[model samples]
Target: MFTSREGVTLDSIAAPLRRWLLNPVLTVPAALVLSGFATATPNTDSIKFLVPVCALVLAGVLLSLNDYLDKQFANNWVSDNTWNWDEEIVVVTGGSVGIGASICDQLLARNSRTRIVVIDYAPLGWQPKQEETRLSYYQCDLSDSNALRSTCERIRSEVGHPTVLFNNAGLVRGVSIMDGSYGDIEATVRTNLIAPMLLAKEFLPEMVKRDHGHILHTGSLSCVTPPALIADYAATKAGLLALHKALQLELKNIHNAPRVRLTIGIFSFIRTALISGHTNVPNFLLPLLHVDTVGEAMVSAVYSGYGSTIYLPGFNRVASTLRGGPEWFFRILREATANFRINFRGRHEVDSQTGKILKA
Candidate 1:
């Protein structure tokens, strides 16, 4: 006896109701309901509080199920062979070292025909054996607008438009807000946020026209929980995450361009050249993950062909959920963590001309 309008009404109300049922607020009630079926149990008072918690947990499981379904739908009809390993051309920014370099190495090893173009100001100590042929290098400073534009032009002409664009160039000036110069803030924002936007704007047209492409952005955990000392860096990353989300929605829902995939990686510490100079953080909570692990995770995300946000180490998802708590709570927790220490020993200054770290 259900009319079309009644069915529509039920559908409209279902999502919110489902969400409310999952919230921690209803955990106690849910626990109590389950207790009725049990013959013997612990104190009744405890059972009352436990019910809601169990309900909330169930809600979370259901939500995760929904997300999985959505992701499966997005990747539907795409075979593993759709990746085109033979023709996969990946372009990684700031690829001279760290996680970027690791990614490049993995990609090259997977397919001999896969060409990798690395854009960086300085060179890493080790180079791919096939640099002149399969691997190409471009020395360009991402912060400079003209340099970026020129580099993009050169890349298009030399290597053809990139099938996979990794917007990974970033900087972290350890100086506190009062101690940091305007140049420091400008350089960080320009390189981390602006350059990615410009690169996407310049290259995305070609990708759209081709009807196939992947854009992977390196977002930070700091974007979700901004630290006091690294405000500028955090702000830039937050902007990058926002940009990635907006672009994903535009390409998927509005444009209906299913072939192009956008992914944002949110991660904590990874062992990389960028942090080589810094003292090791405590392994208990904020342990450093291997650069290879991060690289593999990023590449896997790209191949998934679904618009999604990835959090490394699994626990990052829990931390991100707590980011909505009171500001004082976050501040207190951050101060107590090992991340607050100022122990970076690497060269903080870079050569003005080359953008390479200047020797102390």
Candidate 2:
């Protein structure tokens, strides 16, 4: 079969059918509805089919309107036409591996003229193709605040200012609060939370000055449904979500930069080395998302030139609604998912002073 960049197979009719079923636009079905109206016999069975089809159409319309309104308002009811892919310098944290790597690849595939700057502590996992001259890799440990600041300075001076920043680097210590060492806790917070904020501080001013840029944060579902054994990871994710929300407000109100798009992808468990040993029970309902599926979503949002709140797999938007629901329901949710164990296989010892890896 032929799998496209977005991971949708196009070799068969099933792919488009699946997309039509999932997409809120319902374009294919809408056409079918029109055809049905034109060819319908004046009978009771037609009425039955038409009633359900009309109901689905109505639901699709409402969902589509919600999406349109959200996109417009998130972007301050304005569209930015200033994006020049040829000149835009894109930055990605942890761009060496996992979802970060996926984002880099997807961006490169989408725009040949776009440049990508990858900031990661490790070396690039795969060799870049000979003709891929638009990509630049910078190695930097994001946990250390001083190191992070210096890296940002170098990125600006060396590679030019980044027009799009993907705060995608993150780590998780899959241990309980008490079991985790101080270095583990600190590294998790620094890498996952503080690094993104510091990076924003470095790049956001220029973006605000230009009144054009995009900041895409890869947050987690743990922000709302905090599971057991990964308290530190959950806490940092929760803080990241809160930071994104506040940053969105500050960008508009304080900085007067409504055109600086802020997007956060709140995803469930993804199939990556980061979540290596953590297995989801009844995995069918909470399947691990393909890294490309996420990367495509983030990159597409940036190209849209609008801010967005992306919930992966679409149904995860319920987490937002669940936040405002009764305490009892939330409590039940926590308890139910408590046993979804996280035995992170990549746990490594860190230096207490430096938060750098000591032992694997």
Candidate 3:
């Protein structure tokens, strides 16, 4: 007879394994190419393929080691065994729709004992039935500093100080640097980068005092290799990468709060309203991810009770080492994809004054 643990389902195990095996992350291709060489006649010409195979193996091992070290180093090599879901207050920004909403749902499903406080300017997409008091919604524009502050204060007085913060809310103008207005640039920066910093300022002190909390930022591949036409959005994402790394350092050195875990999710394009009409041509190496899949990963990272640098689909982790490679190669690769957003339409717009999404 077959059996399983409380949360260990077959899909959970098989799905990740399948994704890893099929990913173009050196291992699968290396195996196939190496096998072809081994089966070929013992000639000098056939042996040339070994060069690429060796490089692939080396790259694969290095990336794997980097991934392991990142997680271990962020957690200070300490395993957290003191997590209590009942007392934790989870905060999700942009929780009204798409991936954010999915995260809110999964968090509730993961543990019925925890409370969730959603901060977004839009109305909650799902209705909570009576007696389901664990979820609360706060309508506030993250781009507006004053509004964000007031809303956080309300959350503190109404629910409690958030022990877990998800900086998932973001906006994109989808225009070239010269084509956008000053307001568009400001709104994008404020929403994408500034808001997360301010939110950290509000809650991080409390987390440090208690020495127990988690902060997860939703980052983008633009941080790794920014494409054309989305300069403002990409710049903010790069800033986010810097902010996350800096916060990790400060949390360890200044605050001395190793238990205050910090995690960042780095992902590519997704099937969300934010990029509804995006004209990105899909390729095997770069696939458009599903919102629920990414949301599940983010929620799982939080439950792990450790800081992590999450790269969804696993294959995109190579982006971490891309800049360190040859400049000519990077330039050629970037130039080839320069027109990625040439046909993409702007799916959303933000109102600078009211801090609400005028068009989405």
The number of the candidate with the highest lDDT is: 2
Error of 3 at 280 (Å): 5.3
lDDT value, candidate 1, whole model: 0.71
Q: If both were scored by lDDT, which would come out higher, candidate 2 or candidate 3?
A: 2
Off by over 4 Å in 3: 1-67, 128-133, 277-282, 339-347, 352-360
TM-score of each: 0.74, 0.87, 0.80
Best by TM-score: 2
Model 1 ranges off by over 4 Å = 1-67, 70-81, 129-133, 276-282, 326-328, 337-339, 342-360
**Tens digit per residue, CA lDDT, model 1, 164-192:** 89998787775577877776677777888
Pairs that collide, model 3? none
lDDT of 3 by residue, 152-208 (tens): 899899998889999998888777878767777888898899999999999998898
lDDT of each: 0.71, 0.79, 0.78
Ordered from best to worst TM-score, the candidate numbers read 2, 3, 1
On lDDT, the stronger of 1 and 3 is 3
| Tens digits of lDDT, candidate 2, 116-228 | 99998877986545364588888888887888898888889988999999999987777787777788889888888989999999999899999999999998888888888
Question: What does candidate 3 score on TM?
Answer: 0.80
Residue 334, candidate 1: C-alpha displacement in angstroms: 3.4
